[model samples]
Target: MTADRQAVTQVLSGLAEIRPWYQDLYRHLHANPELSMAEYATAERIATELRNTPGADDAEITTGIGNTGVTAVLRNGDEPCVLIRADMDALPVREATGLGYASTATGTSPDGSSVPVMHACGHDSHVTCQLAAYRLLAAHRDTWSGTLIALFQPAEEAFDGAQTMADDNLADRIPKPDVALAQHVLPGAAGTVMISPGPIMAACDDMFITVHGKGGHGSAPHETVDPVVLTAAIVMRLQTIVSREVDPNDVAVITVGRMEAGTKNNIIPDTAEIELTVRTYDERVRTRTLDAIHRVVRAEALASGAPEPEIRFLSRLPLTTNDPAVTEQVRQAFTAHFGEDRTRPKEREAGSEDFGIIPDLFGTPYCYWCFGAHDPAGWYAAEAAGTAGSDFPDCHSPYFAPLLDALDTGVEAMVVAALAWLGTDRA
Candidate 1:
């Protein structure tokens, strides 16, 4: 490793002092989870935490930037500005982790329906580590000269807040960045880092489809056009899209996450609703997959003599491609702090992130990495004992939870990365 890279270790050490405070803050955010665009209390809590931290002295904090989003800027001089981003939104999943801090909070969805909320995606950890980095960035102003743009964006789970912030002229409000960086917690040995070049995550789209039909008594199948049977056929056909239509070399995942239909077993419902999420690495594959979905739904409905199916797109995010050079720089920085074995290449995930949009708005380099949140030994022990519940869970699972080690390791890696790239031009 280069001497410059070795020196970054000191940055991690200096920032390690704030890890305890943020660890406590992470539990608070996790317990009081909120949904996308409804992160009012979450944002307020973030603002309060920042006010009590080191950066609060010189930071410029703004709230409701994109309907509950917060942005804090701390500038030391004329050097290049680095924007570190974190998302603040919880999923509509009931708590199953059974942790003492597991959320019992519920949020109101866009449709005005009550839904259970949980930090299944670890945004809570991301926000807490972000606060730790902010405090250190302010305390170590002499170690680097530049502006630090700490973006606590909202609704990332919905894949629209980054764009919404842009629509609201986010770049106009704060000092634009020289480079952008962010991270998430994924399944791995605790304290390990994972990143890759090119496409780090898939482009994703959520679609809502409703098959309409005439309602009738279930006893007389001939008397009714069965939308439930039609929906089943449509769901099965949607699965074939990846195997038969998409190229073998390219990857695609189409998951029907939700299905709702009849209220009674004896009554044939007039309509059945389905919610699906599609993921692809290439734009061409994504377009083809979407087209295939529409064709399948419409054709299946037509075959059942159902009314025109209603198809509504819920949300979308372009593929997240990390700048190769910037990613490698952090990879080395991570290796420097945690050793070469602790930092490794992570296979690109089928899941998506809205962070990709930030680089386009600022026209700067960005790298989004994931650190493992679970204990390595415990994860292995569970696997060996054939105990699934005791295993490390994936993000978005109702039972997903990361260990306390995530708080310190995340902050250390983030602090070193920000310090390493703070005042330099993107190569």
Candidate 2:
């Protein structure tokens, strides 16, 4: 075996002892999920666990930096520092997995409605993996020669945690990371690790369009300007942005997620509104898509004799671009540790991660990998066998649940990646 591979194996072997603890923690967090910007208790629990772990006394916990986020520093050597991030916030999804540790925890949302909260997105497993990495790195500090910064971030579900932490100077507080790494649990072929070189996640932008027309009785067809009709026309035309305008090879998606209009059946409403989400990988394509949407909405409204439509673009999650050189380095490390067969090329994912925001501020190398969580014998047998949960719950579904057993490989992979980047002791 190669030196790095052997070293990684040694660290992974050491991690085996904590496998049960990782599962227990995963269950606890899964049973008590918290929402974005409301991860206070979650943060405290994580801090407490880290503080109690061996060699983690030097770990410094800073709370409330980015709303409800937690930042911990684990120092070992005097060499260059690296940052490893794991999101800690859960989704507002109701638990339907029917597991013993399923979340019964409920909270009043910003709208004041009670909703079941669960770690359906696998943040619990993410937390466990990060902690496992922290412990392994800390225990074997003698084998590595650099500082490791662990981020227990909140609000990743809403794509705001990384920005929140960055706004609070979390990056500046520590030595600007030489490399930034994170892992996402995916329900896919078991024991496979996937990575893409650049623009793994698309840029996500929310859109709102309002169409206005004169209100009149339904019977007076000629007297009333119909905005609902205009809105419908615009929606259909918006599809052309991707079909006709953008290159077929360049992926772009424009989806109208919602629409609202007149309430009464007998009258034409004065206004109608449409909500849309636009996703794209290339900047030029994104700009063209947005322009096409605006043009379609305005022209359709004008052609239908309606007032100028109002267009609003809300929160934008920038396209996540991984540095090529850094990505190659990670690929090489994964090949060294997991073998070339286990580490394969991954296609670009349509989803967006707020972690993309990190590269905007610093030049540090940043990449995220997919951690296998699917169980072959279905949920029951997988749970009974203590295998990793499948990607089945889907990301934002109410039934989202992750298999905690898969996190063992996640932790080991992260440690290997960190050590490889730091140029620590070769396997």
Candidate 3:
């Protein structure tokens, strides 16, 4: 191995020493997950851990950046600065993983509803991996010299946590990084890395639509202009936007995930509510798709002789495009560390993320990659049988839980990637 590779391997060897502490930390986080912008306890716990870690004692830690976000800065000497990010918020999904540490925690959602909160997206693993990586790097300062920023962000599920930090003068708070890096837990085999050059994830928009109508007794159908019927018609018509309107060559998705109407069977409600999401890869396609949705919704309401429908957008996430040069650097590092079989080119994902917002604010190049944390045997079996999609629980699912071994994989991947920029060659 070369000098830099040898240094990275020596640093990673410390993983065996720190593994137990981080595993316990992951369990604690998984059990006591908090909602978006409400991660007060989570932020405090992370800060406390940083203060208590031996080599990280000299680090300067800051809390409450954008509310419930935490940052720990470790500056060893004059070297390239690298910002490593991990989201801290949990989703409003109830846990069903049946693990001993499964979350029974609850939190108030954005809509002020009491919902079950779980780390169904492997954010618990994200935080654990980042913390372990920081600990390893801090302890082995002699191996690599540079400034490292570990950012624990909040409200990623709401898709605005990064933006919230930027709005709160994040540029004034932390050191501007030469490069920003982030990673997510995917549902593939554990310890493997997945990466691509550009547009790895899609841009997404969430919309809330309400159609107004006349309420009446269930027995008096003629007196009521039913909004439930109007909403159903609108949903059906909205499907045509992708098929009949958008080009088949391009990709776009319009999904009406939720609809709320009357509570009682005997009464017709005055209004019907629809919560839908739009996903697209291209800006022009996104604009056109959104325009088509507006036209269809209004036209359907008019055809149903209902009042003008109310439409509001929320939780807009930008396309996660990887910087080509930055991505190639990280890809090389991953291949060297994880070997050829474990490091493979990734296909573009339809999922959306707000990570791009942070690097964009500073105008720095950034690369976001995914690491698998699933059972390797099971994942491969499912893939062989063409049952991967149905067998493996996805990020938002209640049953989604990464294997324990993923902690080692994530920490090593992060350390290797960070060392790519903060290597001894630069020192």
By lDDT, the best candidate is 3
State the RMSD for candidate 2: 3.7
Worst 10 residues of 1 by lDDT: 2-11
Q: Over the stretch 105-177, how does candidate 1's per-residue lDDT look in tens digits?
A: 9889899999999999999999998888888766656566678888998999888889988888898998878
Between candidates 1 and 3, the TM-score winner: 3
User: Considering summed lDDT, which 10 consecutive residues are worst modelled in model 3?
Assistant: 418-427
TM-score comparison, 2 vs 3, better candidate: 2
Q: lDDT of each model, Cα atoms only?
A: 0.85, 0.79, 0.90
Candidate 2 vs candidate 3: the lDDT winner is 3
Candidate 3 residues lying further than 4 Å off, grouped into runs, are 108-115, 210-234, 258-273, 298-310
Scored against the true structure, residue 378 in model 3 reaches a CA lDDT of: 92
lDDT, candidate 3, 1-427, per-residue tens: 7666977888888899888899999999999999889989999999998898778778889999999888999998756889999999999998999999999999997778899999988888999999999988888888888799999999898888999999999898888889999999988899899988888899999999989989999999789889988999999999999999999999999999999999999898899999999999888999999999999999998987889999999778888889999999989999988999999788898888898899888988999999997899998899899998789998999999898998788999899889888857532
lDDT for predicted candidate 2 compared with the true structure: 0.79
Pull out the clashing pairs in model 1: none
Every model's TM-score: 0.83, 0.90, 0.87
